[model samples]
Target: MSNSGWTSIAETNIGTVRKVNEDDFLDLPEAQLWCVADGMGGHAKGDVASQLITKTLSDLASNAPEELSVDSICDCIKQTNYTLIELSNQHNSIVGSTVVALFFTAEHAHLIWAGDSRIYRLRSNTLERVTRDHSQVEDMIDAGLISPEEAETHPKANVITRAVGAAVELDLDVKTLPLEDGDQFLLCSDGLNKVMNDLELEHALKTMDTKTISNRLIEIALNRKARDNVTVIVVRNEKQIEEALHETLPLDDTLPLHYSNKS
Candidate 1:
C-alpha cells in the first residue's frame, strides 16, 4: 500500500483505423497518479483536448504535495474542465474528453471519471470493472429496458451522457478502494473495452508484468479492428511500506514521460 512500492506504466495508440490518435494518458509513479483521457471531437481537436488534460495532470504531479489528496486532484480536474470549456467556445465546436484518473494514498486509492472511459481492478485472478459508462445504453440497462448483452452492441453505445467541455457544468463519479499487495488496476479508453470482454482481460492480466499486460491488451484491441483510439494505464502495488522516500526525481517533459503514445 505504500507509495514507494508502487509502479505504473501507460501507452496510447491510434488503433488500426484512425488517422489521428485522440487518446492520451498520464503515468506518475512518483506521485502514484495515473489517468486515461479519450478525446471526442473532430480528429486534431480531439487530440488537443486530450493532450491538455494529460498535460494538466502532469503539472499536478510535479507540484503535488508529498502526499496526494482527493480534494486537490478534484480541484485540478474542475479547473481543467473550465479551461477545456473555454477552448471549445473559442473554436465554436464540441471539443471534449472522457477522463478516468486514479490517485493513491498509502493504504487506499481514489478514482474519478466522466464519460465512458473505465477503471478496472484485477485481484486474486479476477477482473472487475470499477467505473460505469455514462452512456445511453448504460441508462437503458439501468432502467431494465435492455440486457447487458444487448447494451454492448446497442446503436447508441457510443453516445456518452457526460464529458468534460461538452457542457459548462461537468459531473464526475468518485470511488475509493482499500489497497492490498498485488492489487493491479487498469484504466483505459472505451476503445479497449469495446473489443475485449472481462473474461479476456482477466486472462491477459493473470500472470504478466504491467508492460506485457498493457501491450497484450492493445494488441488484442487492434486485432479486433478497434474503431477508436486505444489507451491503457497499469498500476501495481507490489508491497506495503517498503522503504523511506527518496529524492524527488526531476521529470523531463521534452523526453518521454512515464507514458508512451503511438500515432
Candidate 2:
C-alpha cells in the first residue's frame, strides 16, 4: 500500500445464536464514508430499521460533493435519526439502531457514533479506541462506581443509554484527528468486543491485511459463540502509487455493501 490513498473492507455475520442478522453497513470508498448500524427491534423489523439507515446514507453519499466534509455527514445523520424516530413512533414499537461512522478527507479523519458500536484506530502498531459507548455500564465506569473489568460483565452492560431511535433527539459523539499515512480504522458492533479482547484485536490488526483483519475478527468472535451479530469494517490510509483505483469488498447475507458512488 502506498501513502496517499485509502483501502477498505467490510463484513458482518449473524453469529452463533441469532437467526436473523439485523446489522447493516455502508462501504463507499469513493465518498470516504463508511458506517455500521446494529439493529435492536426484534426479528420482524430489525433488519428494516437498519436497512433504512443504510439507504439514507447511500443517498447522502450519492449526492455528496466531490470533496466530503464532516458537517455534511453530521447533518445527514441527524436527519436520518429524525426519520427513524418517526418510523418507530408510527409502528408503536421500539425500533432503534446503533451507528458508528467514519468520514475521511485528505486532511482529516472524523468519527461519529451513537450507542455501543465503536470506532478504533491502529497507529504505529498500537491500537486505541476513538469512541465511547453510550451505555449504562459505561456511565457507571465513568462515574467511578464500577471498574472497567467489572462493567464488562455487569448485568447492565447491554443497557445502552443512547441510540439513533432511542429518543426523538440524539447528540452524536464526534472526534476529529489529523490524517496520517499508515493509519488504520476499525468500526465494529458490540459482538466483536464481547469476545476478542484488546490484545487479540491488536495482534490481528498489526499482522493482517485490511480484508483479512475484518474476516479474522469475525472468525474469532464466532469461535467464541458470539450471541449477537458481529460486523467489522477496516479502512487503511496510505499514499497512492499504482493502485489509485478503488476496490470492491465482499459481504455476508446480513451485511449488504451499499455504494452509490463507486471509485
Candidate 3:
C-alpha cells in the first residue's frame, strides 16, 4: 500500500468451480468506488441483471452530484432497478440482483446495499460487518425465532427478502463512516459468507494482502461447494488525507482546500 492519495488495489477471481459467472464488479477511479453485485433471478438473466446494475452504478458515480449524499446513491440504485425491470420485461425474463457498494472519498466512506451482499470493515485486526442482510433468515434472527448460529444452516438462508428488480420500488440500505490509515474494507457476496465463518474471514483478511486474501477466500468458498456466486472487493487506506494531497501536489501550485471527491 502506498501512503498517498487513496492508493488501493483490488483483485477478483471467478472461483475455481463455477459454471456461470453471475457476479459483477465495478472499480471507478474518480470516486474510488468499488462495488459487487450478485445476481439471483436465474439462468442467463441473472448475469445480465447484475451487469446492468454495475454499469448503471458506474455511470452514476462518474457523474455524481456535487454533494454526493446517501440519498443520491439510493436514487441511483432505484434508477438501476427501473432499468433492470424494464430490460426483464423487454426480454420476457425475470431478472434481479443484490448490490453492495463502497464509495471512498478523501476522508470518509459511504456504503449502500440491497439484499445479502455485505460490507465489512477491518481495523486493529478486528472485523465488523457494516451491512445487514435483507433475507428471511435474518428477519427470523432479528425477531428472535432463531439464534444467529441456526440462521447459518437454515434452509431459507438463501432466500432474500428484498432485492433490486423484485418489485416496482426498491429500498436501499445506506451508511457512512470516517476513514483511517491502515483500515481495510471488504465487500462480498453470499457465497463467501455462506461457507466461511466470520472468524475465518477476519483472520484471512487480517493476515493477507488484498489480492491473496481475495483469492484465498474464494478458494475456501469453492472448496465448501458454495452453490451461489462468490465475489470480494478489498480496500485499504494507506495514507492520511493531508499526506496524500501533499504527495501529489505540483511544486508551485497550491492544493485545493476542498478535497471532496465522490465515487
Candidate 4:
C-alpha cells in the first residue's frame, strides 16, 4: 500500500486538422486513468469504434468491483473486449481499438495494454518504456532483422499484431511497479511515441504539469506529422508522509446524539 498525497489532471485534444477525436479519459477519486484508441478498418466507423472502447472502459472503471486486484482489472478488460465485439457485430463493421490504461494507488501503479499504445515511467529525469509493443516491427527488432533506429522508420511499424476487437479473446499485457515520490507515468497511443523519442518526451514531461504535458505531447506528435489519433495521461506522485499522535480526538458535535454518544 502507498501513503502518498498526489494531484493529477488529464486532457485530450483532436489534432489540428483531424475531423474526429477518438481519445478519452477516466478520472476517478481512487484512480486516474486515460486511454487512446486509434480505430482501424477504415471509413468513419473507425472513430466510432475507438469511442466505443473508451466509453466502455470508462463505464467499467466507474462500476468496478470493491476489491482492487489483478484479476478484477483483467476481467474489466475482458468485458470491454466483449462489448466491442458485440458492437462490431451489431454495426456490421470490422472495427477495433488500441488500448492503454493506467491504474495507480498509493503504493503501486498497474499498467494494462494492448496493441501499440505505450506506457512510460519517468524517474530521476530518466524515462523508461514499461510496456512492450505488440507489433510486427517490434518482433523484427527483437529477432535482429532491424536495429532500434531502423525499426522506428520501418514501413510496417504501424502494423500492430494484436488489439481489442480483433478476435473473440484478447490477451492483455499487465505490469506492476512500485510507487515513488517525484515519479511520473505516461500512457499514450502510438501517435505520440511514433513521432517523439524518449529524450524529447522526457523534456516535454519535465516542463509541464499533467494537463500541459498531455497537450504538449500531442502537439509534438502533430508537429512531426503523425497521422494517427493521439492520447496521453500524465501522473506525477508528490508523495507526502505525515504522522500524528492523539490521546482523545473530539467528536463532531453536528452528528446525531446517538452516534456522537458512541464516540
Candidate 5:
C-alpha cells in the first residue's frame, strides 16, 4: 500500500505435500527488479539452488542498482548456474532450480527465464503469458502432439527439460516489452498455475491491486491444497511511482529493448 516505485510483494508456501518450501524469491522494488525461483524436484539441496539464484542477482542489484539491466541479470544467472553445478558435484547429487526474473528499466520491462517457472502480464483486462515454459509437455504442445488442456493434466507436466544446474551449459530466454499504464505482472512457480487457470488469474488482475492480487492468488492456491511448493510475486506500474522515478517516456516510444530466443 505504500506509494513507491513499481510496488511488489512476494509469498511462498510449502504447500500440503512438501516438507520443505524449496522456492525462493527476490522483491527489491528499490532496484526495480523482482524474481521467483522454484527448486528442482527430486533433486538434493533444491532449496540451496533456489536461494543461490536469488542471492546472486540480489548482491549485484544491491551493490549497483543503476547497473541492473537485462544483460547484467542474465550474466548473474549464468554465473549462478556454474556455482550450483559445483555445489551439486560436491554433494554428489543434482541440485538445480527454475528461475524467472522481471527487471524494470526506465521504459521497458525485461524478462528472463528457464524451466517451468513463468511470467505473465495483465494489461487492459487482458492477460498475456510472457515466457514459454521449457518443459516436456510444452514441447509436445509445440509439436501438435497435445492440446493445451491435456498438457495441464499430462503425467509429465512436472518434467521440465531445462534448468540452471542440470547441464554443463545453461540456456536462458530473454524478452522485453514496453511499460504501460495499469500493466500488472505476475511471476510465479508452476504450483500456482497448476491449480488456477488463466481465467482465474485474469479475474484477479483485472479487479485487484498488486498486494490484494498477491494475497488472493496464494489464498486460492492453498485452498486448492497446492501439492507442490507455491510462490507468487505480483507487480504493477503505478503512475505516481513512474513519475517519481522520471520514467515519463510515452508508451508509444517504449519498445522491446532486445530479443534472444536462447542464450
Candidate 6:
C-alpha cells in the first residue's frame, strides 16, 4: 500500500514445521490500519479466533472506514473478545489469539497490542520495540528473574500470560506517538522474533525497503527453522523522503532571486 504519507506491506508463512498457519493478518491501508494476529488452541479453534478478528475488522473497514478511530477499533476488538469467549465456553475448549495492530492518521500513529505479537519502530536509523510482550517470561523480566537471552531458550518461553479469550476481561495495551518523516514500523507474530534477535531485526529494517523487508525477515525465520507461523508487516512513512527530495531540489536558473528595483 502506498499513499502520500505512508507505504506499507505484509507477509505470512506457515513456517517450516507448522502444518497449519495459525497466524493471520489484517491490512487495510485505505483505513490506515494493519494488524497481525497469532491464534492459539487446536487448529479449528485457533483458526476460528484469528480469522474472526480478521473478518470483524475487515467488515468494519468496509462498512465505516471513514469512522475508524483508536477507540472504535478497540470497541470492535472487545466485542470480538466477548464472542470468542462465548464460543470457547460452548465448545468446552480454549480459543484465543494475540493481536498487535497499527493505525496511523494525521502524522500520528496509534498502537494496540496484547500477548507476544509485537510492534516495532525504526526511526533515525535505530530500531526499537514499541509494544512489550504480555507473556510469562516478560513478567519474569520485569521481576529481574530472567535475562532475555535466557528467556529465549526457556521451557516456558511460549507460555503467554494474556490473549483475547484467555480471560473474560480483555485489557489491551495502547500507545500513541507522533510519526517522524523517516519513521518505519514492523508488526509481527512471535514466530519471526523467536528465531531472530532485536539486532537482526534492526539490521534488516535498516537495509531493506518496505517492498522486500517482510519477505527477507520471513526468509531469515525459515532459515532458522521457525517453529510457529510467522507474519510481518513493514510500514514506511514517506513524508520524510518527500521532504528531503524537496529540500535538495536544484533551483532553476530561470527563476529570479533579485529584482531590478535596486537600479
The TM-score values for the models, in the order shown, are 0.87, 0.86, 0.81, 0.80, 0.88, 0.88
**CA lDDT for candidate 5:** 0.83
> Against the unseen true structure, what C-alpha lDDT does each candidate score?
0.78, 0.77, 0.73, 0.67, 0.83, 0.81
- Please provide, for model 5 over 1-263, each residue's C-alpha lDDT reduced to its tens digit, 9 standing for 90 to 100: 33245788888888878999999999988888898999997989899999999999899998987787888999999999998899889988989999999987767888999999999998767899989999999999999999998897789989999999988899899998888766789999998988877776766665555545566677767767789999999887566323322323332222233311111
Number of the predicted model whose lDDT against the real structure is largest: 5
lDDT for each residue of candidate 2 in 118-199, tens digit (9 for 90 to 100):
9888877788988999999999999999998898778988888877776878888899888665677889999898876676
> Sorted on TM-score, highest at the top, how do the candidates line up?
6, 5, 1, 2, 3, 4
How far in Å is the alpha carbon of 249 misplaced in model 2? 24
Model 6 per-residue lDDT tens digits across residues 1-263: 23366778899999988778879999877688999899994524787788888889888888998888999889888899999999988988878898888998786889998899999998877889989999999999999999987898789898988888778899999999987767778999999888777776776666665566687778867766788899999887655544432221222221123311111
Ranking by lDDT: 5, 6, 1, 2, 3, 4
Candidate 3 clashing pairs, residues 3+ apart or interchain:
31-263
Residue-level lDDT for 190 in candidate 5 = 91
Please tell me which model should have the higher lDDT, number 4 or number 5: 5
**Candidate 4 ranges beyond 4 A from true positions:** 1-3, 41-44, 90-92, 239-263
Model 3, 147: alpha-carbon shift in Å?
Answer: 1.4
lDDT agreement of model 3 with the native: 0.73
Stretches > 4 Å off in candidate 5 = 1-4, 240-263
Q: Distance (Å) between predicted and true CA of 152, model 1?
A: 1.9
| Pairwise TM-score winner, candidates 3 and 4 | 3
Poorly placed runs, candidate 6 (over 4 Å): 1-3, 41-44, 239-263
RMSD of each: 8.5, 8.2, 10.8, 14.2, 9.1, 12.4
Model 6 scores worst on lDDT over the 10 consecutive residues at 254-263
Candidate 1: pairs in clash? none
TM-score of candidate 1 versus the correct structure, residues matched by position = 0.87
Model 1 lDDT tens row, 99-197: 899988868889999999999998766789989899999999999999988887789878999887788888889999997766778899989988777
